[model samples]
Target: MNIEELASILRNNYTNADKGNKVSAIHAFGVQYANEIKENNYLATEIIKKSGLNESYSTELSKGIKLYDYMKNMSTDVENDTEHELLSKLPWCEIAAIAMYKNDKNYKYTPTEVKNLPLVVLAKKIKKAESPSIGTELRECSNDMTTDYHRKTRNLFIRENDLYYLSENGIKYVEENFSYMISDDIDMPLNQILYGPPGTGKTYFLGKIKNQIMEYNKKVFAKKQSVKENIMDLSWSEIIALGMYKANKTNSYKPNELYKLEYIKEYIDDKKENGGATPECSLRSDLMRNSIKCDALSESGKTGNDYFEYEISKKVYKLSQNGIDMVENALSKYINPSDKKEINEDDFCKFITFHQSYSYEDFIIGIRPDTDYDGGLKFKEKRGIFKIICDDALNNPDYKYLITIDEINRGNISKIFGELITLIEANKRWGNEEQQKLTLPTGGTLCVPNNLYIVGTMNTADKSLALLDVALRRRFEFVPKYPVYDIDGIYYVDFLKKLNETILLKKKKADYLIGHAYFMDKKKQPKLQDILNKKVIPLLMEYFNGDKGCVAEILKAADANIVFKDTFHLEVI
Candidate 1:
């Protein structure tokens, strides 16, 4: 293909390649040399280079190296061998067996013996064999055999007991269509709303995203821990021990040492995005770190230590021992708060229900009176869930923060989100030039972090998409979740399909159609009679509004019957 054609193909299917390949391909296209590599050899060279192979070998032909010289010499060496002629007709698998035994790599096996080798063992050896030419050819054949044409028409089964062998075609399919794969390779949508009728697994899909984020978080933690251990001169654990030991001797800590520790804390914060630590702990840590930094800079005559001034009841105080003690006391409530009980994943995730009364203060930040240590309430600025998540995101840049709002349309969007409606935009988030920050009703400035992901579920049947707030709707990309009628082992798939057709015809809308989830039992198996009697009939009655004639006609079309009882409830007949 020409460079222009190739570039177009890549642009359309960039997500198909692995991450490194995708990046390299993009970089190659960006450079001036891309247009010169229109031939297959040069194109293959680019692909090979992107795949982490050496690029120099691609120019061997142009460098006066004869490709057929080595082959001709090898052909002459093996020309008199009778086995070569006999082995030519055999399949690659059998030929591979004969070659392995002939090479005699500390072990020997007859062709029959090698052919009968366990599939797992054979597959591993075939892929890892020292002879790349034989191994690569056999692997290609194995993968090509799994194609639908080969599997159905040729009825070819390279049986490996009950195990399904991975095919080259299968791998290619996953790599090409990776965005739709059931894998973590796909990027999570920044602002996605899964909308559908009730029981269509909208909320359940949110849980899936949460679980994916949780897994991603764990990986980020592990990677950060590894990098921290490998790169840091003094680790956090050792710093904590030294700090505590010094504190025990006297209230006064060394200035220079504290500055170094504070610098290290910044590194940790950058690595973690401040995720696992509580909001109050992060605040206290930041304040203390800043105080130390200020004192250090002041002594060096670079800057003044004026950053820590605070006033309470008209009395000004520096970021001193009193403030530190206050933070420690407040943090004590959350530290080992569960009396050494292990915290679970659920503790970190927040689920907020947005309603008409839900305000910006409630969602982001607020001011509430704090109870004094002795008595009475003190005016205190409180951090809300969003702020806490933002702090966490700031500390842990690699990890994602997910906020799932159920029934998002039930709330007054303009009122609840307020100024945040713009900040939530991908381009307006923190680190972007268009980023926004607002001083909360409490105190601190708040901005939505880039790592924070918002997943909301909306029941379109309850409120049509047209009724949603236009500003709120524009911020989120909606993904429709339709009912699955072709669930395996479900006998009512045809019945539900017919019923949904009737519903759309009668109700004049798709949202009111019955969802497949209603008929699914606890084990996720279909329960036909139970669904028909308890759920389907009752729902249909409400949809038709007790129009018995219309309901009866709908049921009759689906080869089912419903009867109106004395209690005015419809029952399966």
Candidate 2:
């Protein structure tokens, strides 16, 4: 490939390589921008700048690099030709693309290579973006969330960075309207709507983006539920899954399984990208540490278990120590209204447990208020206030609870989120409700939290089914779900993404593949083939066998690929 060819390829795929909002990748990748430069121009300039030369020079360098990389890594040797001379002029090798040719071609260079070109380019960049720290946070909510995967995928918006994972179209929308999108009132407590026709893969793409963010360098939370194979087995499947989870999951745990896997995944992923080990590191066996032990692993199977109650007892001891401190300092701090006492231990522990296992319902509506704050305030009168709800409890500092309602529109929004109409905003929270008493048609009283973030999802089709009680709408920030594809390395995440695409294209029925829970798995994700074999084919029967698709109808949909003589043997096209 010559310079023009190379620049053409880069330009064509630049947007595709983006896999995300072009603006975000440009910013994160350090694309240079001036006041007059638009997002595309800005990115173009950055690519040109990074090529170690000007735009024109960069184009030539990129082409030469592409050609050199493609040929240098070829199985057959490149004789001394213009190619060799061009190699010197070429910029740094597209090391990833060359590796792809080597692998896909099985080291047998042919007339044409670049079979694994996409994988190589993506993996290379992904390696750079993979980090333990969350650099930025972007909020996105989507509609058409019939499937859980759709919602979970959007949930990945909060995974990390300002990069939100949405479908390509969603990304384009943001790219087109990048300026107005960046707003201070992201959490305006308003119900933002994203409306459009069906079959756009709106939800599917959103999930893919979200999954990427969630798994970004954090240890996957191996909750008790994920260990379906029995934690004891630790099969190749489970071990690999655990390794990935550890590598991608957030680093919150003191001794997480993912931390152990981080070095391994990083080392292995690097080797694959760079082709064998570089000078600095080698893929080693010692990378496997015993931090994730079967004996130490809790019954839940994801995380290490507490042993001899020592870990448990250690926490208990801390509590006791804190209690002593609180008791010793209580009278001086608690009695005096103006005392400058810091939050004691008792208050700290309570805050830690807030919103740990909260659900969609908890966010839209307030928790049932407590009937016990006795500073001459009656329980019924203080029902609208959060302080009254925790009135019986000590006056301890609390974490502002945030409830992220994934696909907030999917449920019976009005019924599911009742009475919260009056108390969803931060200002109108706790003591902000002007109404002393607000009751719902369902006879439920609505209370709002002062420190609550009711992040929600709204699909346009479903948006008709209103969420965010008019009161709740006024108090929340509604960020649109933007789809991002360019996460650097991942080629196909949220395998159901394709299925969701298929569902969108077909628009005639449900897509079993894109389940919301699929995106929530903190660890190993089943492949598309696996889903086809397991869930896709089986659940699809609900469609084929249901009244809509009697025996003959299934045959047509199967396109002769599926022989549905009976249930299990049903073929897949």
Candidate 3:
């Protein structure tokens, strides 16, 4: 019903109920209100505002309403009568924390564990559970309600009395991570297209995915014997030194604490007085070899033994139990390192750009001219990049592979993909019953493999997303990458914001706005005048189709240098 009616029911219920039942009555009201709103935050907020509840009680009730809605609509099977009853009995904060972890693909808490554990103990268990990714450790703080700068900066949860709750920033973080887009399906597709204006970092994002794939491949091929050798080469003193470093760095005595590879190598170099003389790659390889072994043991449940106990998260690793104990014993004596570097390895990713001339023959398979016997030209069957990657992925099922197509919308999709478009659907991949293959003109059959993922970057500035081919649209998940104004160290943030606003107001489309990359420099910060003169002004001129006055007006509104006389001029010089 309406907010007023819902608010009146809630107010009356709490007022009439006994003190012991009042809290339960409030929670029940929250559930009822959430059902009525169907997870609409505005309606819930309105109802809470109209209820005349105290600030603290209203905030708690609001969280309960959101938690109820999230749990009810989540992918997990929580619709059964028994599960529903159990959920209704649990505290809202506890359920929120559990629901958060459950939604993450990394965490694997069982249904039995969820039902049996108390909130405080469950929080501890979740902390103890090893997260596969680095820089994702749950941070704990004292109950004194002090400001935690790190947690505040990272938008991570705050722990008080062994229980976790979302901070103000953490709430936004949770919503972004947990909420599904309207077009999103229950199962997120392996094929995704990141579409946005040029320079919005779509390619940059794909680069990150490529690195992750390479890391995955490294882990898949890691040798246990090599790892054992690396660890065995280190003396007991050195091993204890590394372990103590990890413990002090992470503030964790856990068996599988993660540390960065470069940090460990630097510590070793400093300890040896090498004056940074060691080859960087050799040090990195040695560190990775050992860490990969630790990861293997951790995954196989062989950690916490006499030989070793540790694991790698990305390029970071935790030391063994023996190391942690020794470090704990000498906690007062060890010194922490100051410098840290992120790890990067050899490339295994395939990159291609799609254009008007790109075709199915270029993407799948085609016959190419080759020298035959007697020096006569003859056609030979040649496999395309897509087919090659698919074959490789099929052969190497244990490792992940990625194919990135830049400027995907620039090509004629139907002409490029042809019948193979149907083969890319999630169900039509190599292993499924619905898997289908197409016979190429060259006489071989092809099917996209499940282990191979396709990521494409589409520039909206080149073409509107609405005009994309429907067949291609159905197969790939489209993620919108928009311009970011709040990036640190970027010049002219306010000007970019205003310029985009003006463009949107004039053109009625966001696709034509300038992207943040124009103002960014990888090696050094770009001069604003140079950007305005060489990049921004020309782009604006192109966007306005040489209508200098219109461009001048837009620039004026954004507080940029503009001259409007008989001829419009950008006063960058």
Candidate 4:
């Protein structure tokens, strides 16, 4: 059963043991199981002595110690008394305090409400709190809370070993707001293709949802986290740095050289540049290589080996951006279709797949042959590297975790985002079956897990991204995020407003307007004049491109003029 179900059963069985008579009778039984982790009779005795109801079942509980198994065998009466007495001893106030940790952008928890709660109430409170991840101590203590409301509150938010979610609203919320694309059934390859129009938030949102689902695994692999998984997630600029390390070395060649290995490395490395490498992030800079695997033979209509030796032991393969995607698709096949289940066509996020070049580090290039380095010095993540991180954080009793991916669609669509399209769907994971692998262009394959999600992001304006093929577009779910009409924490609406007015005046339905993103200023707000004169005015002129009269007409509406004598204020570069 799921953690939520388990929490409910445990909570129900434990109620009413807090009262004087019930406590006296239940204390001993509670002590026996509580001390199982320690195997110390003295500790067990000490805890049991404090209980109003001492349990005689302690020895048997300590021997098996598996909560689910024990609960299955329990007569409702024994389980309830034992849990309530245990709740009486837990420090609810401390857990409440810890669960209330806060950060700059994410304030999902409040410190004030939890400070003075009674132990039993606090146990329930902590359980009900839904952070991205939670800890063992908190999970146990909350599980021990006997109040049905309190226990169910914790259960209302589901847990996947290291992840957390608002249980009741979890799936719906993710389908609507998360970045990864989710489906109810299995479809190979097309289940998700990051390079298409829906690539951005679709990839990212789905990835996050997968993380939350992962927590349900009963293994207890890692502790939980107290904060939102990507609260201080890297900005576009920071993301570029994560994947910008020298791929040539891993390609088994020296920089500025011409080995097939070096060729592939050079192609992948060229993705993060829009120009002279401006201080502004270069992630949205320029398209790196047409294919993740830079095989000259393929480029020249021939094909062969796609990888090389990395330093000594590891084999580094150069997957074309398309190659990378095929690999992900193959893996997704392993994840989604292994059970031979029927699926509907509408499961995919329909997209207009058009051809476009791509940059480095987007999800289109799922895996690359880069020098894997962990530890002191030697540069961390390269600019535009796409990697997913899975871990936990401390919320209550302990920490929770998250799995994250940045810029999901910057590479070649078909190559990079392979099998994830199928694996990410909710209904398609498996039915009493095992995992499989998706094949890549170079004959490589990848595997997907039920709890893993694929999330990615894209700027709709990029040139390379527009060229996705129809085959790939039919797989993912895309949620269009226009520039916000007004500024929130990230983007703004002033420029977007002025720009849209100008576009409408020229052609009402041209699908062109100032992006809601133009006015975004994390560091400071842009002045009205600065936006109009510098950023907007010139762009409007570019909109008309060569039509001087139409451009002049729109400028007058915004109260600005061309610089020529009869035009806008004049100045020649």
Candidate 5:
């Protein structure tokens, strides 16, 4: 077939295939038309352009052609070759890298080995096998693959003068056999403290985690029926039976009274706009499907009991005692924090900053006076923010609750956590075999739930981890959040890197190093002089304890002294 016919066929296949299978269809097209593409240098480009696919398809086509040529030249039975089997599964860039490696080294890799090898491993192998002065074109190709793949895989290869070379770990990785496939599992610590110098995007990282949770919830919501479909069919009694939809103060209500049809419709529409379950019947349905514990309900009272009982005469519904408990539990778990009255995203992924004044009562529980009572002031037991979150987390076993503590090291851990310090440990959390609970002064018991994750940020510039309470250190995993210098579109990256290097050399610690956040504005776009004058200089002053000479020395290392020409007057501390 001519180029136009092939392109049309490719376009049809691409359009018909699902999102995930589209790349494979493109590869298949290239494989089938490999000879034609090889003969005509511009055939792949022409076909890709005519196919009306994304620009990314051009790279995929090149990769597929290279892979096909390599397989056909290496194998007598090219159509049935094992290497051909991997063409669909592996990334286009990976296939191209393998082809390049085979061409340079004249060494054939088994399908098993090829399947097991990570992109970084192959890139490392290619770099090692090739000559030191490999031609500019080949080196550039290798560099492109390394740049594309290395960032996705791991930081193994270092680039120098547009050439890729393996680091110490990369060398070791290449020497190892491809016995096992690299795992795709990302390690998410249940209790992690991201400790770093200030402005290193610690809270920004927490925001990212919150966004991911929101996206996950959106996906879960997308698969279900539309809001109108779920709400439009439900009666006023059924909506009230869910217990989330309540009559406003303006609307009169008697005992066991069903809301008027107009009032119910208004409430449902308001819920759809603001929050709640958009009729709450959909939420009940979801709970019944995912969160309801049938066995637990059966054990609690009667077997084979539905969550709600309906009275035909009154046209009203009553929730079972066990069902009330189950619905309360499910509501906390399934409903987004934003859905609840007077609650927002902050209520879901709670954020709190710790300071010297922050106390155990403020964190867990405390006694406060109740002035609202009739006569004199009364002392009452009140749960703190942490305790409130813990209660919700305990109730909602299906959902994950996050409490992000900013400036964690500023507070006294022993004073703040009190006896509940041991409860935060992974093994000691509720539902674990070694789970432990502490009795409060108010006679209530408290345990940190398993579903609750505590992520804290500590500025090392204020206090180092070694100096933190041993009990706190032992219970939490510390993940270092250092300044990243290689951010795209950020000017003065080289200056920041040099400044950090000098700080490490002089201070003998990374704590005093400047963070990348300093160079960015509120919009996260890079800013230059204003940040240097206002934020960066002031921070340097604090680090050096107002010693202008030391601050000047560090800035000079980065050739940034020109910005602070008037500020540094060589005043020794």
Candidate 6:
């Protein structure tokens, strides 16, 4: 029986048993399935030992059973009784307050009704009060809470003396908002290629990896944006508060008090007027979007708030004097006059891939015609994606940008990359001591940044790695992806293994064999006959170049009743 069914039976049988007998039965069962329990969950072993039960049955009912075991143990503790009892009877307002307290941002503004009250005191009031309308209080409090500076900043409208109020609407708002954090995980290889035989899901795997890369970038950006500058700037109490919030997100733990101060709650009235639009943010947004479109960035969409400041920093480094003035005018709307300063756009750039016919001019700094403000055409030195992204990374030092090349091998690496190929080396990366800054054809120097990562996808089934540029080959790390086997309860995987063994022994090669992914179906099991006729037989026919007899032999070995026809098709008998 499956674990769920087994668990249900155990629960039902023990529901009405004597407490002492139930504990005894649990211990007995644990001892009975000790080996299987040990293999399944490590946590279950600890729970079983602590509960005075045999370790064997822990694995079978860990999810449902261990939770009850934990509660029973906790309730027996004398010291936790008062806090636990109060926690069990908390009103919804106190519960909401406890949840909101975990976030540090919520401490920026307290409700006017509770303005002078300490967090603990307010929580007690919430717990003791009857028919408490926390939402109505918050609405009344908001009218007197906002300051002039709060009105100016769109993201911080509800801030008073810096302690945010908790209400039903506030809770919903925080829940809806996506948490941004810069990824702490940077375990990716400097350069790696995903390569495998035909239809082995190599390309599909590349897309998945790309998503992870984006997510990493998003997380880092999110966490970084959580507080001003770095999280190191937060005080000890604030750091502790943030940690509690993260723990709550993971464990779904409720507060012992009616309210807690371990989280942050931001009150964003989305309909609240977000101040007058500053021309700078709007112009910069337009410029970034236009830049992405002009360079033909694939899948370019609206960027998040975390990307806003960084994108503007890049634009400053790339645009001319006339462009800088326009940006300064826009910047004037949001930033204080004293804080406004010129930024160099000389190095930052977004990358775009040239599908075909890319040359030095397209890949590097080249003269391009552009219309002047007066509608007159003029020639200007246009920088490429490599120079731009690298420039931005050098300036920020913290932010990382990725330039992905789909079907990287299809491009003429030597012609497109030019002198940059040597610079692509790990040692030659921008921050390295031995970094090479080469003078371009236009008499300008360029360097690739250490923070910038280059990601690309390659299909070995279409072309051999031997066809790749030797220099490029040596620079990148190639990860081989062969056909997979050992899919649990998947007979098709075993059949493919047998077929591959035959191919490797007879044809003396592995690449010609079938990939296990071709038979994968997690949602609904596919028919063996359908898999062969539509997917398997056709692939085999192509691999053997219509050698029907050879295909038939391989099929028979795998116990397939499909027949190869003169039409170069497969049909199940």
- lDDT values, one for every candidate: 0.52, 0.33, 0.59, 0.34, 0.59, 0.50
Task: State the lDDT of candidate 6 residue by residue for 350-396, as single tens digits.
Answer: 33554558767776678899999999999989987667766766786
Q: Which candidate, 2 or 3, would have the higher lDDT against the true structure?
A: 3
Tens digits of per-residue lDDT for model 5 on 47-91? 889888887788777766666765433332334544444444554
| Better model by lDDT: candidate 2 vs candidate 4 | 4
Q: How many backbone clashes does candidate 6 have?
A: 43
Off by over 4 Å in 5: 1-56, 59-187, 217-343, 522-527, 562-573
**lDDT score at residue 536, model 3, on the 0-100 scale:** 80
Error of 3 at 395 (Å): 0.8
Model 1 has a clash total of 8
Estimate the TM-score for candidate 6: 0.49
Model 1 alpha-carbon drift over 4 Å, by segment? 1-186, 227-344, 377-379, 487-491, 522-526, 546-549
Best by TM-score: 5
Give every collision pair in model 1: 272-395, 272-396, 273-394, 273-395, 273-396, 273-397, 274-395, 274-396
Clashes of 2: 35
Worst 10 residues of 3 by lDDT: 133-142
C-alpha RMSD values across all candidates: 21.7, 23.1, 17.2, 26.5, 20.2, 19.2
Work out candidate 1's RMSD over C-alphas: 21.7
> Which residues of candidate 6, in runs, are more than 4 Å off?
1-183, 228-396, 442-445, 487-491
Per-residue lDDT over 1-573 for candidate 1, one digit per residue giving the tens place of the 0 to 100 score: 554554455454345544424433333232323334532435545543453434653332121112122211222123443323322322344334323322222232222223323321323343443322432333333423233222222111122221123333434332332212123332767788888887677876776777667755654443333322221233332333233332441334333344334323443433333122322233334333434344423344422322233343433224345334533553333122223222245544778887777876777777777889899878877777777887777676766788888888888888878778888999988877887877765556778888888888888777888999899889999999878766544457788888889888877888888877786665666556678777877677777777777877888788886666665655665
After TM-score superposition, the amount by which residue 392's alpha carbon in candidate 5 deviates from its true location, in angstroms, is 1.3
